[model samples]
Target: MTNTPANEKWFQDRATEQIHLEQLQRAERFNGRAAMLGIVIGIITEGLTGAGIAHQIGLGPLIDGYTACRTQFLPFCF
Candidate 1:
């Protein structure tokens, strides 16, 4: 069809809508990364707590520090 005023308006509206959608997607991505970081910090905190407990009980040799903790709630060196 010919590029009439109505057609131009429609295109502009579509473009605006696309920009809004993209903005929302970026916000979601940023929030998701932040949430992941929080989760990792929580895991590290738990690892530290476990290590402290092991140390208190004289079991420090069985596991590593919190930095190497993965999968298991506590870090195990061996």
Candidate 2:
């Protein structure tokens, strides 16, 4: 347990690493919360729209376009 200069530097390095790890953990938690909020918002929007409502929002055209593309690019798709 000698309080040598190298020992002090090692302790400082570990402390810096620990601080970085804690910061990363906090950031991850914040990211998880943001993702959950987005999911909740999406669910609410989808529920408000109700089932079989995509046609009202012009998704029929989008789906038709996708179908056409898929049909054209059969090998790329399947």
Candidate 3:
């Protein structure tokens, strides 16, 4: 077939689609690896400090406060 404008546009569109698909795959791979690394780090920290990830990150007190407030039926809890 001749190298018409329509053919050029079609080829460009296909190329763009292929590039986008590749980028998405790469991003997904990176996200998965990062999540796995975070889990491993959390486990190591917990083993070393005898504290869970939430406690290490200071969420323990916040959670405890929420639980206490819920049980006490505090007016501001809602």
RMSD of each: 9.8, 5.2, 2.3
For candidate 1, the lDDT comes to 0.75
Clashing pairs in 2: none
lDDT per residue, candidate 1, 1-78, as tens digits? 689999999999999999999999999999999999977776776587764545555666554544456557564633
TM, every model: 0.60, 0.66, 0.77
- Candidate-wise lDDT, in order: 0.75, 0.78, 0.91
Angstrom error of the Cα, residue 76, model 2: value is 11
Question: How much is the lDDT of residue 20 in candidate 1?
Answer: 100
8-68, model 3: which lDDT tens digit per residue? 9999999999999999999999999999999999999999989989888889988777887
Q: What is the lDDT of residue 33 in candidate 2?
A: 100
Task: Tell me model 3's lDDT, rounded to 2 decimals.
Answer: 0.91
- Provide the lDDT at 31 for model 2: 100
Q: Number of the top candidate by lDDT?
A: 3
